[model samples]
Target: MVRRRLFSVNDHFYQGKPRYFIAECSNYSCFCVHVEGVQNTSCRSYLLFFVSKQRRLFKFIQPRTQLVATQCGVVKRIFFSTGELSGDLQGSILIRALTREALSRNVVVKVRRYISRVVVKSQKTFQLYGLGGSLMKQEGLELLQDTSKISSIGLIEAVPHLWASWSMIQNAIERVIEDPPDIAILIDYVGPNLQLASKLRKIFPGLPIVYYIAPQEWVWGYANQKVPFLLRYVESIGEICDKVYSIFPAEHAYYQRHQIASEYVGHPLFSSDWKKGNETNQKRARESLQLALDAVVIALVPASREQEIRYILPIMAQAAKHIQDQLVDEDVVFIVPCSRDDFRAKIQQQLTRSGVSQFRIYDKTSSSIVIAAANLCIMKSGTVNLEAVAMQVPQLVLYRLSNWSAWLGRNVLGLQIPFIASPNCVEMRLVVPELVQENATAENVSKAALNLLRTKHEQQRMLTDYERIAKVLHCPEGTSRAAKSMFELMQTD
Candidate 1:
């Protein structure tokens, strides 16, 4: 007689507290963990933390496991597509929250993820696969596309990368049709993401599409007469787009006319567990970097892509020089936190070429540490600005584009951006001084930085504005709002 396989949860141990439990199967390919009191009393959530055969760790997916594993329902497959770095970051936060709600009785979520994968046996696991980067990978996201296109507003400039972007779209469409995830989440990659959605909607007519951090469809899609088509495919959105949707008022409106779903759970940046250091942590960061307490630390957050390095970093160089020339006696250290490794050498090289050596370039520097040390930040208009605000660091936000790019957006695309930074856009006021295009010069940026540096009032005003912005932007329920909406829509009869 041969030893038979045990079908039950062969072993279980409470990792930390009494109620929380991790149940391991005899085969060891499948696993489940329960954290009691994590969600509301109406339901219980479970996490699938099993490693696949490939050693890819699929983080927390709520599925029927453990006690009622036999009777619990099947795992819902969520197709996620995050186009830019910010989207990837936001997607990670949203994923964790959703997984937690499946188990959390109290709704509080702790996001922790080196997630690898192995073979997942016949177990109900909410499978999450998408097109994203490291943050998603850390959450065990099976990134579909390798092309991380950092798109900019430029017809001539962005043409070279169009083929690569198209390839990504094709891959996404092929995957959706072939495997066909139960639902799809499209982050702010307007071109490829929208194309993928359009194709998936046609192939899988009822497949739900969630556009998290949904882009300005009015300008990019509607103005071009493409949005109305894409809108038909979208089933949900991560943000409120009534104001944006209203722009295309056909009076007899279609999908673009109605509000899909808004998470309003506050900005994902606020929900992020990436914390700024307290006085102690700040002090430690300063000491480790050998930065003085009185030194004026200016963080230069340039870009995550090549174009930004080519165009934006040079402007930063000029601005830094001007700032140095103006504040002759004040001690300053220009710290650059390079977003991508490909541009790290280039950033250092450019700084060196500019003969600016009173600087430190860190490829993997923590944004929190940089924010903690810096009195002010000179950054490109991106997700990093949100990090600056959360850390209570005053900034002179800036952006520059080639004449061709500027023409492309203004003349060709007919885009009217009131504010590039999200905070400024929130209140319809320039919460921070933003200089763009021709206005973004070394002189203008230095003057702005100097004014903010000299006046304590300006800094305090920013802090005050930040508080107001937080109140307007932060959601107490966190990313769970988005996650819950997605699940409820999927589970609806």
Candidate 2:
């Protein structure tokens, strides 16, 4: 005989008004309670309850998860677009770990993306690794869940297009209304995040939203345009958000300028295992690169993104030639550490097209290894430059934005900072070489690179300065400090 079963909530339901709650005994899907005493149109004690399925139980949208996973949690979701994931997977990884930690404390964490699948975590631990984006569609998640004791980890894929992202994000909010989390941490990916925050405020009006690794509005020269929306969603968070964290003191100024409240929590990069490289690794890497024992190896790292590659690769090839000619028997080898194989192909194509071949491209070697091996580095000014500084590699920085965009930046916005490199920005001085826009030429970069290779005293001084900068930027409390601040606000709300 088929037996009838009642949905067990271990709590009483109010029959006079609509209510929201998770059906824990019934696949844990969100549900609404309709008042039996009142008509559907009656407003005496009626409420709206939107049932939404959470992602603590599915698989990644893509076949392979390309995002970095530093922390573990009950729900695993992708935050940014594949295009934005570009070089570093740190933010994704870090957040995953942080979420997992929160979940261990019995906090219900929900991950929102631009996908349609429901992801739920049934295990207490999980490891997320990127295998060149070739994810096993079915097997890995279950294996991880069983072995690691992970309670739930949903690998939900969103539908394509920005609207789909909005829909998925909205669904996450609806789920939160049924089961509120301690805090909502939106990690980077500014455009979609901003929209999600706005939608969330409408539903979970009191929920605190913390922005991690904020957009470079100052660099984009449009902090003014974006600040208001940021304030609107973050305003409630501001009053009770234990601490609105910022990566730098300058960022606090931006928040203050816009009248948006924030606290200077310091940079995350420095808090990682950013230790100096061993002398032995440096010696071994130099030997593998085929440099003379006494000769200084000047590593040349251009930007990893496709657009940046187009403008920077040619300049690097030319710079290599220039340096070779200027410093007679200087033994300066151009080592390019590429993020993807296509980056290597692009650089090779540029050199082949120009009939030049005098450098080697590095892949197996980590950036830290490259930094340790180099006497000096000529790098594209982005996150990599910061890595170089932490590794004590004195650098000559070069960067070029899209032509049309550069024109608008120069003409309309009038950028305050003369240089684009973060190391220079942190120092508020040209502590390293920066050749931007028209100045990022082969001759200019090569000349600067060669100068450092020959000048030992200057390189040493630069290293000393880098050490100082590292000390200033390093976050003392690490992820816990930021996590605590965000958690306090989320719980209080």
Candidate 3:
């Protein structure tokens, strides 16, 4: 009877060999599952549908608290993986947009065709959960592992300790393998995520894995890790820039050549809503932080990640001290805006040790306001750089990766591209000075800031370049476009 029923269901829903997924039913020891019996093809679909219903019934009884379920019959479980401050922010934005779109449509991903419109009420719902930071928590993603905890560039370089974190990595993979989501959205924080994506593809071979804010190593050179990762793992590419395709056609074309879905989702920063918030809050932002209008304020914006703070905050402080020493009589307000609350004490320690204890560490206000209120910015490379650009503040960018990692990125990888900063990359020239590795010392940073402040002509030139950057980056519907593309991926997915 089961065999006969399976054949009837297969004939109704699809034509080819039926693919099956085992869904465990909780109440009893006899979990309903796919019997891969070549002798019993008839009842396959019917049994699977029955099992899914039983699982839903089990979930309802148990009251699964974490995952969000959609209205359609087949539940669309979406998982996102991200590590680092910027990745957390981008991941949060992407999920919010996806949820908004998903909720608006109120649609499920898969429903058995054998069921009529009257019976369609039996379909499973849409749900999303995954790994990320504080923002993701607010958006309702089940925290798989706090990716924010790994938010250190220098810590990533710590040899044995980094390897010791492999158990956490294994846990992340096991969670996915145990009950995989329909879609896996991998944000930036390339190294670990690429490793995870590669392993994930092995478990769920055909699962649609989409990448947003895809690594920009291609912007530097063809020999970067991006080529192999994209070729081996990613099924789709969602870019943040319009010029990326043109800038790296060979690398960009690799996605198309492999039949992977590709899209030019505009930068998330260019949206009107973000700009309005940045624009409207300038005065209040200053007042709330008690920033005097006439005071000369220079923002020391460093890395949001732990490794970044470990390496960058000290150097940024050294530069700030240099700038302050040069302007002894002038009342200079040095504002260091931290991204995470956990790092606030460490930041205060660094400032105190550097003899810059008087500097205000504003963790309460947005980095946008800090950058907006500043005459100049001395920062490490990250979202903060773009935030500075978004606010039209002239900035000096700096970066220092771990020695061995830096050597590999240069020697083994052959990464010789110029312009580390995003705005500079977009402009195809140095709109702002970039000091990397050894060149990112306090004296060099202080010198650049001094020149920008002292020379009005150079400042104007940089500001004009910023205007062009703003124009290039402006996409009023960036978030909407990204959301739309994700849906398109879902439809064919």
lDDT for each of the candidates? Answer: 0.63, 0.52, 0.62
lDDT of 3 by residue, 310-335 (tens): 66788888888888899887789888
Give TM per candidate. Answer: 0.74, 0.64, 0.76
On lDDT, who's better, 2 or 3? 3
* Model 1 regions more than 4 Å off: 1-72, 103-124, 217-257, 272-285, 288-290
Off by over 4 Å in 3: 1-73, 108-125, 151-161, 221-260, 272-281, 402-413
**Candidate 2 TM-score, true structure as reference:** 0.64
* Best by the TM-score measure: 3
- Residue-level lDDT of model 1, residues 1-493, one tens digit each, is 1111111121122223222222233343444565555543233345656555565675545443322322113345678877666777767777787676544322111222224333332332466787887777777677886445546545666787788888877877776555556567776766677667767766655556666665554332332344434233344332212211111122113333445433344676766433312233456667767799888888888886667887889888888888887777989789988667787788888887876768997754365677667888898887878777777789878887778878867766655666777567565578999999888887888899889989999899998998887666566565666677666555521
Q: Model 2, 21-57: lDDT tens per residue?
A: 4222223443334335543221222222223345363
Q: How many steric overlaps are in each model, in order?
A: 23, 45, 16
lDDT score, candidate 3: 0.62
CA lDDT, candidate 3, residue 7: 15
Backbone clashes in candidate 2 total 45
What are the RMSDs of all candidates, in order? Answer: 11.5, 12.5, 7.8
Ordered by lDDT, highest first, the candidates read 1, 3, 2
